[model samples]
Target chain A: MSVDAKERPLTPATEPFAEPLAELDRQRARALQMGGAEKLAKRKAEGTLNARERLDHLLDAGTFKESGLLARSARPEARAKTPADGKVAGFGKIDGRWVGIVSNDFTVMGASSAAINGKKMKHIKDVSTQRGMPLVFLGESTGARMPDRMGAIGRSILGQDRYEYRRMRETPWVTAQLGDCYGSSTWYACMADYVVMRKGATMAVASSRVTSLAISQPVDKEDLGGWKLHTAISGLVDVAVDTDQQALDLAKKFLSYLPSHSNQAPPTYPVPEGSDEPIKDILKLVPESRTQVYDMRRVIKTIADKDSVFELKPGFGRAVVTALARLDGRTVGFIGNNPMFKGGAVDPDGCAKVTGFLVLCDSFNIPIVMLVDVPGFLIGIEGERRGAPGKIINWMNALALCTVPKISVILRKSYGQAYLNMGGGRNSDEVALWPTADLGFMDPRTGVNVVYGIREEDDPALFKQKVEELSRDTSAWDLAVLYEAQEVLDPRDTRQYLIDMIEVHRLRMTNCVGEHLMRTWPTSFG
Target chain B: MAEVKVASEITGSVWKIVANIGDKVVEEDTLIILESMKMEIPILAPEAGTVKEIRVKEGEPISEGDVAVILEK
Candidate 1:
């Protein structure tokens, strides 16, 4: 028993309650010890914070109100050894907004899953969902507890909850993958709308050790589930950071732009004191020669509010840049193609990134701004193997379902289906292009070569003449004569055009967040 | 010393050679310009290094992932 519990005097009416209350206090103290002081010290030695320390860093000061504080492992032998049943869950303040958090205590049997911990997590998950409060999961577990969750008794876990994976998106959900995240940890990480993983952490359905044992060959942890896999290939994690503090800070930063629930408008910030960066700079950043590659981030930074751009999954989709930014203090989802990577072609990774970003924006009522300078969809044997066509269709499907205001500015080349996917024609609220925009199905040289079967070496003069003839079809004047594209503004006028477009569409706001069509969409690719 | 592999980002015919074997180049220095869509697309050196190998000759067709130059740092 704790020092305080044994000292309290027992009255005749309260005599029966005295022993039980002392027992409760003793259990709570043991639970707080986690795997004991030695293990906690070891965690600190590795520069990793323990369970409660993570919550302290994540939530505002002294706001954490823990639930199931006295929870013990259901397996009788494991009760004292598994305090909080290897999990710590509670309600707390994130930027003063109520949120529920579940942090796994890795000191206890590698924070393996047990029935008591599952119940604790389920309680917070349900309560957070019902109240429309954001829930954050700090995962560092090693799959299901083998002893308790096996055989006939294990079947009870599936029947414990009927409403599984039903996310109404009433409130935003965030997850942080800190260390060895297997099984349920991986599932919840994928279910979160925004997930951040730390470097050197592994997140997979099964651990490398188990896979090695099953296959009779050693498996590298990184090969199974590393930050690079999720960021560049699987498209599961949104951001990868270097520290636990950075991961926690990112989750808090994401929630700042959102409302406590879907019923309210996304929060707006005070416009920083400045006119948009000299619009003339945009022309300088974009290449006059259509074939040249230039950094598109320069243009994005100039147009968006100063220092407000936060890029997500940057390393994954090298060709396309999906980011969150403020335009005149209003939160907006920003997508732009970087020609520096693969000549601004939409690769499979780019397609997957854009699709998820569009869904997120549409669900939260954030307007989209696209800086389009696409060549076309990437073509190769690799593209086919990566399922590029299906991803392209998914991206188009998402674009069609988006009800938020979309404004696109075609900087230069906008060719093939890429133009349609980037909010051309009836897909967007407004579509405008620069005077130098090249709108066509394909490049002029390729068209001439395909039509006339003439190579530059075969007949240079004839090929030049045919190329010039085809180039005329791609000019902005051709589209302007048809009145298909909106006013062709000077590249410098793009920033003003976008700012005015956002204001022009604001009057159409119905005031409340929509019945978010993508509320229950898979947060990450399964 | 680490060797940097200079891979082409797009498929095109090499139009001009701006750097040769043993040439010292700085990051972003255009080593070769490819002709695509009748436009000049330069393949720049990714980091400062001495050109150790000229992997692809002028007028050679190169696609994405095809290494055109190798630099010794």
Candidate 2:
């Protein structure tokens, strides 16, 4: 009736507890336990999750196998004062795939990276690289421990092994910005394949407190390292969520789309039964009235596999929406403008959003689906002040650099510079338009004013009559006659069209080279 | 005791500003707007002042947070 020892799951050996070395191990365990408890309480008070809690939420239940549990600082005084040097380094399984994790506990002397902690982190990274395991960093730190890093010892620990930061060709890495992530935390997050952040979390080269003092200004955390600043302005962080749990969930979700390592194929998940719906229903999702706005998000959700969309920067850029979603269980990045905002116009912020999203998708090998209903880039002096011109050019540049399979669906008003920016024509692998699409340089009414030089107020009745005449020339049929779009089809067929086109592009050998852009994009903003 | 004011920058509406005249205004305190694009580009006070004049109203079309009046501090 006794179970064979070799067949059982490994357990801590009792003999090790009885040996003289047991005292040293117990002391190490006690220090770590106490440090963990205090850190957990502080983190809870701050409305943040401790490193271990974050890791637990990130990995599958009961799957973590820790390493370097006994490593301590080499600094004589600091060694006795810190336990595990405030870091928990180990390996764990996320969705049955192995991943390396290192979580920093700020409660232990501010979670500063001392000599031993750095060594532990470097070792974990090295092992993950060699084994081709995905590495995850649950980063929240106060930078390098000043005491340990101020002298000769500091000089020795200053530079990481070049190979440590030199991203391995195959291993995927992810980082979570859980709290105040400065210095090393920021560095690791920048290096990740996917970086997720809590809404109020701060990730910057230096903490706001430090920067404020240095610059002599009252620094607000959001202003200093807010999601808006990073996601919209710098494109440093990938996605920002509202809660700690959501950040953890995003990390898990992002990893699901990527291979455990570059050399292997991405793991496939079971297609949820009955998830597929008729692609024709996508037509009804968009409103018939060109002036009446509908939520692009609803259309996106309907066309994509049920509940597969994971939106990024949902708040910062109200005009354009970027999301990572799955269609038929295959990962793709979706970029579209919400007609509800500025009539789906590409404003400065919207342009920035699309540029960042395109770069991310290109870098990550995620094919793109551009849902176009753009009136055009925002015009007028306000747009110019906000650098609209620069952002538009930037978006176009990013679009041109993209090598992934890009499919453009002109849901409606594909006008002006935005038409080219939204992967129209040569910018896309396949371009299709809904029956109602109006692909043009500008709205017909405005086009008449610019072309005819007739002021609307000068003779309202006459100008109105001319505008109506001009409107007759712009329509989906007009663009089709010129072959601006490959084909104009019924709205309901959009999903199938995209699915078919993506499949065709995916099969091409050229697609592979473009997918590697994610691997080579600079990890941080200079 | 008072002086005429002009718009600092040209753009859109007065999104918001941190200062008003007769409110112990200090130099470099954001006076008002021109909210272009999605950003709130601020127009700071040129000099510290006392209640002088008000030009732009919230939600009103403002090329800049135009100064209607001046400070006598």
Candidate 3:
């Protein structure tokens, strides 16, 4: 007969509790096995750490307080093998801040199929959202398990987890695509605020094996979803690292720069020590010749704090360079036109990139610094087919919706609707310009051709004189005289002016965060 | 020897081909000029090489990343 422990506490003499205690010890041993020692050893041989080792490296020492550690698969045969339901979900400290982590244990059933895995994921996501902590997903799953999800209805029933698909950007979400990420993992990658992918990791909706079968064509996994494809072309993955260690480190660093949640302002480093390097160097970096293309990246790095720029999507939509940097220790998002690509004309892709960046900065309360040098939107058969106008207007809407402090500095060639899109005239809180800035409906050469109906080839001498006449009227001084731009600054004074502007405008924020005007705008997947 | 292709960075009409086929060019040499967005964009040779082929003639429309010249070293 069993003793009624509910009536009284157990004593040392209680013989009935001995067997149950032994069983508890056995269950604990089973929970810790995590697909057994052989798998762990194999993973170690692969020159990569196991799930627990990764958690050890990612979280602060002695800080990981795990939840759902004893959770096993619902299937009878799979129950003993699928320790922690092939998933590790818990709260931990990263850089001394609480963060929720969900890592798939690829050793167990390939971390692919389990009902409780989805539930555990939801638990961490909900907990992270409620507790105002960032969520990290270290996914390396092989997609839904076919054996467990064999029935037709089983596939549909899997989506029943309410929190799995529903997105609430209460806290920053970061994902690390460590290995073969498919199905739900791909969705999480897209939905994340930032994603770091391992160089060899394959991320897609389905594996090449299955995709090839369905389409009846051989598909290379790398070509289908490679780091180069995402970083340079698709603009899906934010950062790609060569090692798993690097991915974890970069994630921690990225979070350190951002606020814990959207309601708060981003963390700011101490003001840059010592005076800035002579800003006069920017003059030498930028070519005065309107026809020449110089490296805009150099100009950005020189103006912003030294080594502060962290560029996003450096390959895709390369005509525009979007980066997060510090100006006088204040976090600012920069959108500068790269004249090296498409002469800094905002293409359809570039428009989409800028729009998404504006929404992100607005959401995180990072102030914006626009270095305008766009000639105009891409005008061609391809640009039209790509829906350039739709993208342009969408970006314009985002810029208008952004409540964060926006300061526009026209470097050169601010023309067409692009002038407004780049925060010209009334669009920006404060508009400044360099002495060489040109603000107009179009470039003077194009303006001359449109107005006079005389091509440059038809009358070379007349065209040159006409362009000069138009150019004289379209200078930065003309705009300043008309009270269009507030100040026409020298190129050297731009850094200081921005620092001062940030200080002055920041007074408008009471608790450091803005009104969250574009809070609901979706982050761009590309 | 390696073959290099100099590509235009903008969608524009080919205004002029400065370096003819079989001509020698240094790094940063303008191989072809494209007129787009009301500006003349010079497609430059990435390395010192001899021009192997001219991809497009004058007045022909070309898109971004379209190869304008091939160079053999």
Highest TM-score scorer: 1
The residue pairs found clashing in candidate 3 are: A235-A526
- The residue-by-residue lDDT of candidate 2 on A1-526, one tens digit each, is 0122234444455755455555555565555563656657876897887766777788888788777766777877766657777888888899888898998877777778777888889988888888988899988888878867897867888885766567634577888888888888998887876788888889888888899999999899898888868875666777788888998888888788776665454554556655557455665667676755667888888778777787876655667888888777778889988865545666677777777677667655678999998878767777798788887887888888887789998888878778899888799887888888876678766776798888888888989888788777577787778787788878877777777888888835653435454455454421
Model 3 backbone overlap count: 1
Candidate 3: docking tier: acceptable
DockQ each candidate and list the results. 0.37, 0.04, 0.34
lDDT of 3 by residue, A179-234 (tens): 88887678888888778889888898899899999999999999988887887677
After superposition on all C-alphas, the RMSD of every candidate to the true structure, in Å, is 4.0, 8.4, 5.5
Q: How many clashes in each candidate?
A: 0, 5, 1
Model 1 clashing residue pairs (backbone)? none
Which scores better on TM-score, 2 or 3? Answer: 3
lDDT (CA) per prediction? 0.83, 0.74, 0.83
lDDT of 1 at B40: 69
Candidate 1 lDDT score relative to the true structure: 0.83
- Angstrom error at residue B53, model 1: 7.2
TM-score of chain B of 3: 0.95
Model 1 chain A scores worst on lDDT over the 10 consecutive residues at A1-10
Ranking of models by TM-score: 1, 3, 2
Q: Is the docking of candidate 1 incorrect, acceptable, medium or high quality?
A: acceptable
**Candidate 3 Cα errors over 4 Å, as ranges:** A1-29, A152-157, A272-275, A278-280, A507-509, B1-7, B12-62, B68-73
